[model samples]
Target: MYPLIYGGDARILEEVLEGTHPGLSSLKCRFCQINSLNPNLVKGKIVLCIGHRGGSEAAWSAFLAGAVGTVIVDGLQLPRDFSRIYPCLHLALVQAMVKELPTTSAQQGTGDNRIAEYNIESGTSMACPHATGAAAYIKSFHPTWSPAAIKSALMTTATPMSARRIRKPNLHMVQAISILVQNLRLVTGDHSVCSKAMNGTVWDLNYPSFALSIPYKESIARTFKRSVTNVGLPVSTYKATVIGAPKGLKINVKPNILSFTSIGQKLSFVLKVEGRIVKDMVSASLVWDDGLYK
Candidate 1:
């Protein structure tokens, strides 16, 4: 119902309906009248229902009756909203490939079937495994590193997403894994590479994403300290830059230039945010760019 929560599993319901009679006409029932329905007819077939009363309750009722799944043809229309519940592939070819996957055992019938070609679907479900795989790969090289360290590595290295310069950045795993591997040797060799003293808060843990909340009524200054372990060439320099800062907001990066003397050398910097009264939310980014890397 309502797009079936995007990735609702049809096989789960099919498994529940296994060995039960199929091809029975789907029954329509009120949300509260599901228990009164005849189980024999409801079992092993799709259930069609109206989602106006409650989508979740109706779906649960169908599940209890051993229905394969529920499809809501009509419901209360709601406002448009974006959800990160999962990722979606906008490509038509990918969507078509997914639809061709064998959903029933009958589709896979025959002995000694050696399949040479395959197609796949993409979503948060798909992305999650890739992220986990990246983490596992990093773990292979840094067997002694803790989970938090690996997570920090991934988060800190991910590419930032900017929408119309709105300053909202999402996770980019490819870039994250690249940076993780690039700095793996330095991180593994230095016990102090994952020090908590470097981060001012959980949000500032060299994370790939961050948010800053400033009270509107009072003028306040917030300082965040961050440190980076040099894994590149010895004696490298990086410059700090802030983008899309709001009016009346002053940002200062103490020692804006970071100079590293050797591999495994750690450098610290202070980010001070001073803002006056403001009515609207402000978004910005603090970036440290070496000539070759960001």
Candidate 2:
């Protein structure tokens, strides 16, 4: 089942699964009701009563409401392929727009007029499903992966939002690469690295073969991966090391490796820094593929 729950609350999900509450076939109320005004006045018009970042949630809501499509004109486009991102998101906006938008000349007076009825309105909950859906898609592509591996790919591949005001995908495509490595572990069964290993050490990795700078007093962190193909590998193959981390600040890695190839597939990761530092930035780069392994 494609479960879609909020970031928190696992108990409610369990209850629903146990049949205490209605199963997948249940009522769903969505935010961002659509408004039908002059198309000329509001070119891509969909309305949300709540305030959110870039109105992204509301914009997608309208798509599901019954609009042909949605266009989030702020710094919030998918950081990756701008095309597929809209369809998934537009579902909400289309649903909202369909409900609020009146029948057109072509569909006028026909039995199809039920479009505005509650039966016609379409909706989904605002929860982690968005992330889960992405995760599911990854699993579908690479069925043999561990949970950690899948998570790594998604996080690493997540495109970083640009400074521009329009929404976009996450930029760090490293997530997928890391998940593949995690899968390698499942195959070799050489499991030596501890959970702490994913946390990684402080050193210069130089894996991607690029230059990065971490200013003095500034804490910085980066992730690496070993493999993501072949479904029998473990989820902890990629070893993490941190170097030149500034003082007063700490670097952290979540599920250090990318993807694993066992219970599930697809991978992602998160690198975060906390505390204060004197430097403005720190650099991390990949080790170049030279003749001998350095």
Top-scoring candidate (TM-score): 1
Model 1 Cα lDDT, one tens digit per residue, 1-294: 223321122223343434353432222243312443345666665555554443444544555555655555443253111111111112222212333333332113233133324434444454577788899999999886677678877875686544444221334646754565337656456543433345246546554345566666579777777777776678789898998877888989999999888987987877888868475566677777888866
Candidate 2: residue 277 lDDT (0-100):
54
Model 2 segments beyond 4 Å from truth?
Answer: 1-127, 162-294
Q: Model 1: residues >4 Å from true position, as ranges?
A: 1-124, 137-149, 162-210, 214-218, 276-281
TM-score, candidate number 2: 0.25
Clashes of each: 1, 111
Which lDDT tens digits does candidate 2 get at residues 1-294?
A: 122221111122344434643442211212232221112322233322222223444344443434333333323333311111222322332223232344432123223323332212222432245667788998898786656667766654465322343333334557644765557678556664535355544333312222334565544444433333323344334434555555665666665544344533544444555665564443432221112211
Global lDDT of each model? 0.55, 0.39
